[model samples]
Target: MDAPYGQLIEAEPGVARLLAPNPTPYTFTGTQVHLVGRDELAVIDPGPADAAHIDALVRAIGGRPVAAILVTHTHKDHSPGARPLSATTGAPVVGCAPLVIEGGTEAGFDHLYAPDRVLADGESVVVDSRTLTAVHTPGHTSNHLCFADEAAGILFSGDHVMGWSTSVVIPPDGDMGDYVRSLEKLRGRTQDRIYYPAHGEPVAEPQRLVRGMIGHRLQRERQILRRVEAGDRTVERIVAAAYPGLDPRLVPAAGASVLAHLLELAKRGLVSHADEQWSATA
Candidate 1:
């Protein structure tokens, strides 16, 4: 995905996006911080605390009054920049309530966010001419949200769904059960025509991708179940069986994802874990 960072890339009539310069293997060409309203601009996912990114956002607005600074969730890559941007523009940061998540060890999660106005599910806020509704879709994290612009038929599907790659569902903060339910919720909603995902290109057929994502997750679960039934119970072994020739750099994440699925399956009484080994329940 090409991110025209310094200038505003017009996505549609009222929507424009600024790319943050903090791209990574996970972030995928930096975070696509969006300017939602044409006149009374609403900044969404300020994208890290880098001065340059925030300055670029301010520049793109071109002295427009920022109605609100909205956040999709409190990940370091998503919410850390909101405070600095708000301080610069005097726009109150509003979105999901902060929920502390235990990141275990490597690649920690952010819990230092507090929104000025907490938005509940089905809550709508009119900024400029657009009505952005909050969709409480928790999966990637306990407080993950996807904002839906009904009039434009575009949904800002945070990290919950992406066009570039499947979202990584790690345990502790991430839940497979909630992820599946959230995908179902999006599939049922007809208001969204395109998904402007945080880290990738716009998803034109969101429902089709949602179905495929659901199937992919379930199939992975089945593979884990099969591995467990075949006497491979630990996360590492399951990851090895499910994702052969996996990149060494991604092993930790793969293990976390398998653990999340195992935990979910265990919660549903479909599997059991004891003495560090898992088994399919009869």
Candidate 2:
């Protein structure tokens, strides 16, 4: 099957895809947004720092003034080009502070993104007649946000939600506790008819998909608990047993998920971790 990005499907009446390049492993999918209603346009999650991708965005906008460049998070694949693109278009880049790198790791290129505007939850930005409200939904990363276009009833879901695979819950930055809460928050929201995720095709059934994601995570947590009860005394062993069918290439990512669950369970005193191993405590 063809990759979802580059497949231009109408998101709403005036919005059209200047599609992101598919197969770019990090972004894997890309989307350059165009808004038709208000003459004013905004590009969300400009994929990567690729020169060609930025050029494609410029061509798609056709000299239309880009009002603002909005970002959901500061992951390398998502926000590295914000500064350059903002310089080209004179649009103020807006988002959470660039992610901080710690303990000898370089700051993932995202640290260079100095957003001119910092968006908070419930804050709204109006471009022409369309109003995009920021919803602080942190999970995939501690700094993720989703924008809801009130006029279009569409949610521009960055990695917070995706149409393809479930997002990773990597630690020290990604939190499963917050991830679950964010999913529940979306479940109670009212104005989302379509979801334009940072990856994969647009999702039509937002509520249903959110429910499925929530259920899947809960099931995984239970599976981990079962493994702990069955004499698995380490995250590695528990992950191997619980996620038996996961691709070998994805084991590292799966291990992170298991770590997140273990951390959450430890916080609740339902499990304990000692000397690099896990065990049921309650």
Candidate 3:
């Protein structure tokens, strides 16, 4: 049966998983997480504020004590339900601070999160017999976090990593440099064999997936540079040329990705910008 968000694909025993009903240009899929253990189970990324979805999650957990509600970031589709769920279950909400972009408002973050527990990089939350370690992998959003479960050997990688699509790097909320670094950090980790991303199925070979993501970004950057060499100076023009066949609806997102790449390229001195136009510098 198909849910409103996307098809549900169960991964790893003891974990109740469901996809949200709403899929959009922005949210490829919605993920509901339920972690069951002895003392008190927890839910991560409880999905949107939909009552039915939240109800489905509550039903799935079946009166099991909800230990905590964890959020990866403050994106609307991801964190808006934390307050209601916390109130319903009396579970403490936990997450990093909402990402604040310089000279810009907190676009989609939830100021209402008011996490009872705030996670730090490398911090771990012990539930029953499992340990969920928080890895601050900022890139998709500055406050993003990935939870590594030592016992399950899995990583609940919010938007930091995905099985089907590349994560968007929209600045000033996103940074390509930080994204690449976060990918590299994941590559260096030794424990995780499977990645339960915020969207799509569980990734069995995370190292391979990480390498592919890094390579794809690099390739896209090269294409953008080539576009610059061919006289497409503005981000809009470059994105049009490089992503010629992308859905029109996705062009705006593509522009954001191009902007992120351009920003990173500028930092490396490979490209320079003047008058809002990018040019190859080397």
Candidate 4:
């Protein structure tokens, strides 16, 4: 998807997006700041605290009364601009709970994200007469949320379900089991017709993609179990074996993901790690 940076492109009726110029391997074509509703807008995932991006958002809003500034998570790339945008438009910042996991700051978390209101799972916030329900789809982060506008059959899926790539689950806060369960939760909701992820193109067939994501995670679980059984007894070794010839820049993240999987497997008694060395238990 050739997302033009700083341009407000209409995704669907009453839904438009402006791409933030913060693209990277993890962020794909940068974070997509979604504007929902027509006259009264609700900004979702305001991206990084980039002055230019915030200026672009204010321009796109065009002095319209903003109902809310909704955030999916507290990731630095997804929520830092909420405060500035809210201040500019006088809209309340609301959505996912604020989180700052100790020792997890280096993971790109926005420690200063102080939401005006935290929406719990299944809770709906009315914006411009449209009810946007918050689905607490954790695992990408413990406080990650996916907002659903049931009336429009549109889901603003955050990093939980991205079209570009599977979400990386780093342990201590990120859990593979919870991530898979969240995927299943979305799969069960056949109502969401389209999903607009924060980082990539919209998913028209969210169910299919979600099912595939579940399968992929489970497949990775099996592969990791096999690797442990075969004496690939460390996260580094498991990452080397599972993600062969992976980019050097992403190796650390890959190792974290492997540890997450191993931790989940240990919970199920399928694998065990002692002294930082993993081994199959079953």
Clashes (backbone N, CA, C under 3 Å), per candidate, total 0, 1, 4, 0
lDDT, candidate 2, equals: 0.77
Please write out the lDDT profile of model 2 over residues 3-103, one tens digit for every residue: 44434445667666655564543344454443333367777777677787777677666687888888888877778767778879998887665666565
Q: How many clashing residue pairs, candidate 4?
A: 0
Stretches of candidate 2 off by over 4 Å are: 1-9, 22-38, 101-109
Off by over 4 Å in 1: 102-107
Model 1: lDDT of residue 115: 85
Instruction: Please give the distance, in angstroms, between residue 119's alpha carbon in candidate 4 and its true position after superposition.
Output: 0.3
lDDT of model 3 at residue 34? 43
Best-to-worst order by lDDT is 4, 1, 3, 2
Q: By TM-score, highest first, what's the ranking?
A: 4, 1, 3, 2
Candidate 4 weakest ten by summed lDDT: 100-109
TM-score of 4: 0.97
Q: After superposition, how far is residue 258 of candidate 4 from its true place, in Å?
A: 0.9
Q: Note the residue pairs that clash in candidate 3.
A: 4-21, 5-20, 5-21, 5-22
lDDT of each: 0.87, 0.77, 0.81, 0.91
**Model 4 agreement with the true structure over 1-282: per-residue lDDT tens digits:** 786889999988899999999988889999999999898999999999999999999999999999999999988899999989988989999999988676646557888889999999999888788999999898988999999999899999999998799888887888888988999999999999999999888999999999999998899889989999999999888899999889998997898888888999999999877799888887
Instruction: Name the Cα RMSD for model 4.
Output: 1.2
- Candidate 3: regions farther than 4 A off: 1-10, 36-39
The number of the candidate with the highest lDDT is 4
